[model samples]
Target: MTTAIYWFRNDLRLKDNPSLMQACMAADQLLPVYVHLPNLEQETPWGFQRMGQHRKIFLDQSLQELRSELRDFGSDLVEVPGDVLDVFEKLRAQIDADVIYCEQIQAPEELEQVALLRNAGFKINPVWQSSMLDSQSLPFQMQEMPDVFTQFRQQIEKNKFRFAYPVDHLKSIPPLPAIDISSTQSLGRNTISTGGKFQGGEQSAHTHIQQYFERRLPDTYKQTRNQLIGMDYSSKFSPWLAQGCCSARTIAKQLSEYEICCGENEGTYWLWFELLWRDYFRFLHFKYGKKLYSPKGLSKHLGNEFDSEHFFKWSSGNTGESLIDAGMRELKKTGYLSNRMRQIVASYWIYDMKGDWQAGAAWFESQLIDYDVYSNQGNWLYIAGKGTDPRGGRPFNVAKQTLDHDPDEVYRKMWLT
Candidate 1:
């Protein structure tokens, strides 16, 4: 019988997982594996752990959930630590597999991994399966995509596009081929979750999607998405979506169903609109390649250089602005942050410190549990005016933001005092 390996990258779920599905189709038997690259633990260009505590806990949760789900399919996920190349080389020898399959990754190092694997005489099947719209259905070619979100949204509307269907229930298979391997070990991040819990996986994502739609949360999203407090204020889908625990297409399909029942509005539309922006950033990665990481980023000759000490202070929530401090502290304490708070803190870092925007992006990369390459980098670039935003440097007024978003000093005192 044919044997193949399916490598799990950020895309972890089986539901609407095109890469997993394609792997199943191509192999008579499959080995599902997750490789943890140890080098990411090294310090970033900025002096911080590349993966922070909150993100590590969330990732551990997501992987554990994936293990449980894959168990239902009569397969188990095998995790290996060290350089991805070394791990894969070891796996190929152990499994003696015919081919390897994985989802396409747009980031610089990730793409380089694919090239290295392909050159090693392994057949690599990299599939596109992350976004709401299928690559084939987008109004513009991925390379020719519009510069702004509105232009992209209008084009998508004018063309009358639709989302792809969710994958059908998976079929059971015999337990995957096992090889002699040691037990997986935990990776380190400074913080650990004590009583804190964040639900993970396709099941939890689906549950949240149902609750949000049933409660008509999307209808009120535009108004409350900016709210700085509470779980119900927004969809809370970012953590799942960021790690590919849920597919954006699946969310969009359910969204269409919600609009059919409760009716559509700017609020509902904005969610999809944001999804489009997500897609745009992914496209940007594909188009620009390593440009996203350059000092200039996607813009021409625009960047800031500031004191590293100030960045550390801002990162640790000791900046001394109540609202900004509260947000930064919350981010330090929890991997999550409200969108408004994210913008506020980012503005403080950029305009206040006069620090390089890339440094702030790197800080977010270290701290955020839900940091998606596209959203995290895209947002940092936008706020710093080095990416798609024509208007650079949005200097937030901290005093006004405190009065506006935390008028009672409740959120401020809760985090900052």
Candidate 2:
């Protein structure tokens, strides 16, 4: 019998998963696996844990839900904890699998992992199914894609970008070949409270989407999305989207349905606009490659310095700038912040504090439950004037932002106090 290994990376949900489906078609027996690397829990160059407690808890919960769902299909997820290559080598010793099927991740480290496996004589079949629009369908090639987000969005809108319907969830998956998982341990839970606002799982993700549409949240999203507090301010889809419990295409499909039922409005259209931004960042990784992670970034801007003292104060919510401090405290406490707050704090770090943008980006990577490599790097580069933005770095005036978004100090009071 043909046996294949289906490796789960960022794409965790079974619904709308092209890679998982391909694995099923190629093999009569499958081994579904998720490798937990030790580096995730280790300290970064900045002396902070690579994965903070908040994100760790969410990931652990998501994995648990994924494993349970697989059990319903008479299959199981073999979670191996170690270096990916090491675990794969161990698995190969036990089972003569022909190939590994998984989602394509554009980031450098993830791409390197695939290369390492291929060099070891394992056929890797990676499906590009994460974006809302397929890469092949874009009007321009990755090399020729626009650097500015607006230009990209206009081209897509002018040409009328279209996405394929999401694939249906499998009713039953092929049973796994016998393999021992007794040595592997599950991801550890966080002692930090999640504020009971977010839970990680495909089921929970779908429920949130359903409620957002049913309660008419889309109609007011454009107005409230920038607010500093409140659950209904935005769709709250990023955490799940980052973890792959929710697919971008599925979200686009649902938004289209919502428009059809409720009639289209600016609020609804903005959501689609935001999804386009997500796709732009994902595609940017293809064009820029390793440059996205570089200190000088794509623009090759120079003269950047890191101040550990300033970084510590900024990260710990002791910066003394009330607005910046409040946002930092909220993120430290909740593992979340509004989109507007993200930009403001990022600006303060790069422009005001005159600190290295890379440090700020790394800190976000360590803290955010919703952190995606593309978005995190892309935004930081934009703020530091190192990425695609022609105007060069965005500098937000803290006082002006305070007056504009939180004039009444309601948001400041909530977090600061």
Candidate 3:
């Protein structure tokens, strides 16, 4: 009988997962696995744990939930800790698996993992399913896609391109291959839910999106999305999206139905617009791969010097600028931040503090529970003026932002005082 392994990466959920479906199709028996990589605990050059407590706790919860979901389907999930390559090596030998199937991740590090496994002679297939729109459906070749966000969005609209409809949920998955491996472990089974007002799981993700639309949240999304505080200000989809607990296509599909039911307006259009921007960032990796990670990204200019003292203060929220400090503190405490706060603090680091943009990005990577590699890198480069944007860096005036977003000092008082 054919045996194969289905590896789980960021794409945690089974619904709308074409990769998982492919593994089931190709194998008579299969093993599903999620490896907690060793690199997560390693310290970065910026001097902090690469993965913070909040993200780690949320991941444990997601894995535990996925484990429970798999059991219900008569398949089991293996949660183990090791270098991904090593974990797979042990599993392949133990099960005598013929091939591995997983969702594709286009970032440099994730790309390297696939390369290493292939070099080891494992027949690995990495399917692309993270973005809202399918690359195949786009008007232009991914390599030839537009360099700017506006141009990309225009082409998509001009060609009438929209998100691919989500696939039907699986009725039954292939039974697990009988095997005993010493490397396998269960999820830490953390009781803590997702950071601050969020819960981590496929069920939770679906529930949150269901309620988000049921309440007609999209009607006011554009107007309230920029607000500094409150759970209802925005869609709050990023945390689940980042974890792959729910597919972007699922969210967009719900949105299309919502638009149909409620009629399209600026708010609905803007939410679609934001999802499109997420796709734009993901597509960028195809046009420019490793360069996007470099300090001077696509430009001749060099990067900023790293200042350990100031970076410590800035990240710790001891910078003494009330607004910047408040935002940073919120981020560290909650492992989440609003898009507006993210931009303001990122700008402050690059332009005002004269800090290295890469360090700032690394710190965000270390902290954010909802962090996605593509969006984090793309946004930081945008703020640092190192990316493709025609306008240079964005430097927010703290006083003006304070006056505009938190004029009453209510937000400041909560986080600062």
What is the lDDT of every predicted structure here? 0.81, 0.89, 0.89
Q: Give the TM-score of candidate 3.
A: 0.98
Q: Tens digit of lDDT per residue, candidate 2, span 1-417?
A: 988899999988989999999898888899999998899889888889998889988988888899989989988888888898888888988988848999999999999999999999899999998899989888999999999999999999999985557998776688888787566567867566666789988998999999999999999999988988888999999999999998999999999998988999999989989989889999999999998888888776662698889999999989999999999998988888889999999999988999888989989998898999889988888888999999988999999999999999998898889
Candidate 1 vs 3: which has more TM-score: 3
Give me the displacement of residue 194 in model 2, in angstroms. 1.8
Between prediction 1 and prediction 3, which has the larger lDDT?
3
Q: Would you list the clashing residue pairs of candidate 1?
A: none
TM-score of each: 0.95, 0.98, 0.98
Worst 10 residues of 1 by lDDT: 186-195
Q: Candidates ranked by TM-score, best first? A: 2, 3, 1
Greater-TM-score candidate between 1 and 2: 2
Which is better, 2 or 3, measured by lDDT? 2
lDDT of 3 by residue, 165-277 (tens): 88878877888887764457755645454445777889989999999999999999999999999899999999889989999999999999998999999899999999998
| Best model number under lDDT | 2
